[model samples]
Target: MKPINRRSNAPVFWGLFGAGGMLAALFGPVLVFITGIAVPLVLILPADAMSWPRMQAFAQHWAGKGLLFVVVALFMWHAMHRILHSLHDLGVHAGTALKFACYGLALLVTMTAAWILVAVGF
Candidate 1:
């Protein structure tokens, strides 16, 4: 019987993590740009008439929601990893406690985001 090699998992995990981080970094700025430019511009436009359709179109676009989800998930994942590692370094090696805290934070953020997304129709 051949022994299984668990080391192979490391590369795959790091690859996915790196790729996801890169995508998050790349899109983050674009998301910021849209929020800073498009959103404010839309809000500033006179709402008397002729701008209703544009506003509706903007609302219907999924770019904002998509960007938000990507940014948030990535940020959470990165933060959770870094924070747990830092705690471990600081001699807090209670794995169960750390896991519970991280899970709680992630769940809270996910629920809040879902509520907002649903409310915004996105």
Candidate 2:
């Protein structure tokens, strides 16, 4: 019998990571259902609906918010990797420029999320 080759796992890893993030997003609703608490639907609605008390509750529930952050950050990292590589493949080969642009965007997104999480006291 021939041995299985396992080199083509990058796509598999990315797919699983992305799916996990989606699941985490979905889990928020499940939590709301179980707890009978109306958490702000950040994933589905605009920031205007997010109130201070809701934010405080969200932050206080460490597990859910931490899971949310993990999902978002991982998804962002994976997306940035894929996007930068795709741009490079298209011959946009200013390596330093691409690197800085991608990293800067990622940082901005992360900071925004962090601020929201903190502002909500989560």
lDDT of each: 0.61, 0.64
Work out the TM-score per prediction.
0.55, 0.52
lDDT of 2 by residue, 37-96 (tens): 343444555554456676567666877578667666656655676687788889877477
Best by TM-score: 1
Candidate 2 lands at a TM-score of 0.52
Report how far off residue 121 is in candidate 1 (Å): 1.9
Model 2, stretches more than 4 Å misplaced?
1-56
Candidate 1 lDDT over residue span 16-39, tens digit each: 346557876787686665656656
C-alpha RMSD by candidate, in order: 6.5, 8.3
Worst 10 residues of 2 by lDDT: 33-42
Clashing pairs in 1: none
